[model samples]
Target chain A: SAVISQKPSRDICQRGTSLTIQCQVDSQVTMMFWYRQQPGQSLTLIATANQGSEATYESGFVIDKFPISRPNLTFSTLTVSNMSPEDSSIYLCSVAGTSRVSNEQFFGPGTRLTVL
Target chain B: QQQVKQSPQSLIVQKGGISIINCAYENTAFDYFPWYQQFPGKGPALLIAIRPDVSEKKEGRFTISFNKSAKQFSLHIMDSQPGDSATYFCAASTGLGANNLFFGTGTRLTVIP
Candidate 1:
């Protein structure tokens, strides 16, 4: 298991503002992912942050709206640009273990963003 | 299409009783299945996991039963306790290295003392 932490545990942002959430892991990891959890909903994969490469995003999400950067193995960031009330959700980061068979993931304490 | 489906959005189990949560997946490529537990104001934590090769895996009081032919799996918690009350999520992943998890809707389990 890995120790993961996210900055700005929470924040309240205006509708037009932007906020970047930072995720840091104690040890180096192979894969890092960003997720969004709406109120009373399941977790949605926002993107997969690749070290030294552009993040791979899933459908219903885009790079222009949710830009991501992963400079190294243990660090990544997700920036929600031009936020809106509908953008209010808990943003979480996770790191996948190196094991090929198991490959479990450890998550960071999410960043709760309340867009008003 | 929804990749993963979960049942019993909420559950109430008496202490020391059995707590069961079921999940099914549509993608046969998904080889990894994991159960995550989340408390209020925190991120989800990996509780237990299973691979396709195994029919069942037990860790202490928690057990995961996998039926590969049915494309389904379930989590069984023996001797439930109040501390076990939390939102449980079942997730599946293909060859994406477990980074891209297709999470189920989640089950809110309330174990009463």
Candidate 2:
């Protein structure tokens, strides 16, 4: 199992300001992902953090708003730009399991962002 | 399109009773089904997972019942306790690993003593 940690357990930011959340893993991983959990909602995949290239974003998410950078296998950062009230949510980073059959993903203790 | 569909937006179960949450997927390409448990102010943790090759997988009090033909799966929590109260999410993904997941809406469970 992979151990994951996120910076800033909670943050209150002003609207229009950007907040970057960092994620660190215990070891090298192949797949890293960013997700957002809104109030009383499910987890929505933001993008797949590729090690050397641009992230693969989901349908509704875009790079300009939620930029992601995976400099290496164990570290990645997500920046929430031009924040608004709607962007106030928990941002989490996850890593997929090494075993193919196990196919599990471990999530970091998300960063709760509250936009004021 | 919603790839995964989950039922019972919320559940209330008595202590020592069974709490069941169901999910169905429309994409046949999905092979990995995992259930995650999330407490307030915390990220979701993988509770139990099962592949399509197995019909059922259990870990302690948590069991994952998968029906490949029906494209559905359910999580069963037996002998529910107050500590089990939290939001549960069902997710699916393709391939072995390295793929993004499609998550269900999630179910809030309250286990009353």
Whole-model alpha-carbon lDDT for candidate 1: 0.93
Model 2, A14-112: lDDT tens digits are: 999999999999988888999998999988899989999999999999999999999998999999999999999999999975445546788999999
lDDT of 2 by residue, B64-103 (tens): 9999888999999999999999999999989856578789
Which candidate comes out best when scored by TM-score? 1
Model 2 bad stretches (over 4 Å): A99-102
Determine the backbone clash count of candidate 2. 0
- A22: Cα error in model 2, Å: 0.4
Q: lDDT per residue, candidate 1, A1-116, as tens digits?
A: 78999999999999999999999998888989999999999999999999998999999999999999999889999999999999999999999865554468888989999999
True contacts kept of each: 0.70, 0.74
> Where does candidate 2 chain B have its weakest 10-residue lDDT segment?
B93-102
